[model samples]
Target: MNSIFLKAVRNIKTLQYFPTNVVRACGATKSLHTTNVRNDLMEFFDIKKNWNETNIRVGRAWKLDELRIKSNTDLHKLWYVLLKERNMLLTMEQECYEKMNLFPNPERIDKVKESMDNIEKVIRERNIAYYQLETGETGERPVEDVVNLVGLQEKYEKKEYHIPRFMNTRWVQSYLDHGLFNSMAIKKFYRLYREKQHNEERKARNRDMNHVIQLIKRFPDMDMEKLKAEYPNVDIEKAKRSRKSRGHYVPKY
Candidate 1:
């Protein structure tokens, strides 16, 4: 008898809480922060008005400068809100693809990502500041230049080791007898790699010189001061000396 009474009360409460129109509205979604039913699965869908709309215009993303002004507590709250918004947008995108519908305002996802990135940047800046104030070092992991087996430079994060290099025979052996970088082939590869890098630099320098000569031929009375400032690496005098820089009209230089 008690169970029957409890069931009847629950049915009445459901009807009173969710009317026919309100229940139908639950099928559509808006911001969970604005809605009373945050845990509802239907929150993944777009609002009823936007469901059939061709355009869903939104503003620009949060800039790093704007985010930096916000407090940490506000940032933490906003992070979760953006996370929920991303979840809803992803769900709607997938649904649209499955149903062969045009996804509206797809760039909103990028804006949300940009905002989240700014938040992370602000947090990282705060952490770095706090750590530098307390200790003389940044809290970020220490990274240093290291050479790989291919003799290429790489940024390697330092790891904590329980033992020293001398005590760790296996670690020492990895860099000595068994290391691929210690081979004659690796040395040859490094030499070839260096030659390729130098060749690229030389080509770039020649291109800059040729471009400057062409500029001198084309625009004889162009701003010499501005040109010098633009290409500090290229000597304008050498370009003016070039025969290619000679045009129908003589250069001002």
Candidate 2:
């Protein structure tokens, strides 16, 4: 009977220990889960203390080199964090502006924008590198030089071709016949363009010469070196030969 009683006691003790172990595990798991949730929430936004502050102090932006070393998942999470922070700052700024109050530290917006740009640049660099490694080509849209109707060369981005270049009749006819458009009008346009450019240059030269002549007339003892330094484009020797440059005083010789 004592043996059976002892066996019952042992079984009861075992059962009690099992529940204690389960309870401890459940408590630990709960604590860990709460911690993880708190961290996630904290990381997604700024600290709670900064919520109502007029001027929130922040450090410099994340450098491209620093971000490049981080893993892709880390970068992705950081982007969303920055994006939310930017939106919040913008909202606060707009509110302050509406209230006719000064928005402290306006440079913060510029810093955040710069950081976002750097992040995108780094991502593009990585993408290009990966593409080059895999496909032996830079994965970007191709650009080409083409002449426009105005007879000026311009850059045009090439697109995918379904029809071959020679098969397009409209494109071929446009470039083949220059006489289809009035050749006289083109010549007249070119002549006017050249005349406008020449007039501007002539006016600039005359203005410089007149200014130099006035300077000489006003300051008879002015330093020639200073005049040359001030107007590098004006030829001092040619100015000396001008009738306006001759002083009214008679020659002593």
RMSD of each: 7.9, 9.8
Model 1's lDDT to the true fold? Answer: 0.87
| TM-score, prediction 1 | 0.68
Best by TM-score: 1
Per-residue alpha-carbon lDDT of candidate 1 for residues 64-145, written as tens digits (9 for 90 to 100): 9998899999999999999989998999899999989999999999999999999999999999999999997898998999
What pairs collide in candidate 2?
none
What's the lDDT for residue 213 in model 2?
80
Q: For candidate 2, lDDT tens digit of each residue in 1-253?
A: 9999999888778758786555464576455433244534345444568655678677898899998998889889888877987976787677677888777777888888888888898888989999999999889788999867655568998887888877877876776655524567766876797899899999999999988987776666779899999999998777776778767764121
Each model's TM-score, in the order given? Answer: 0.68, 0.49
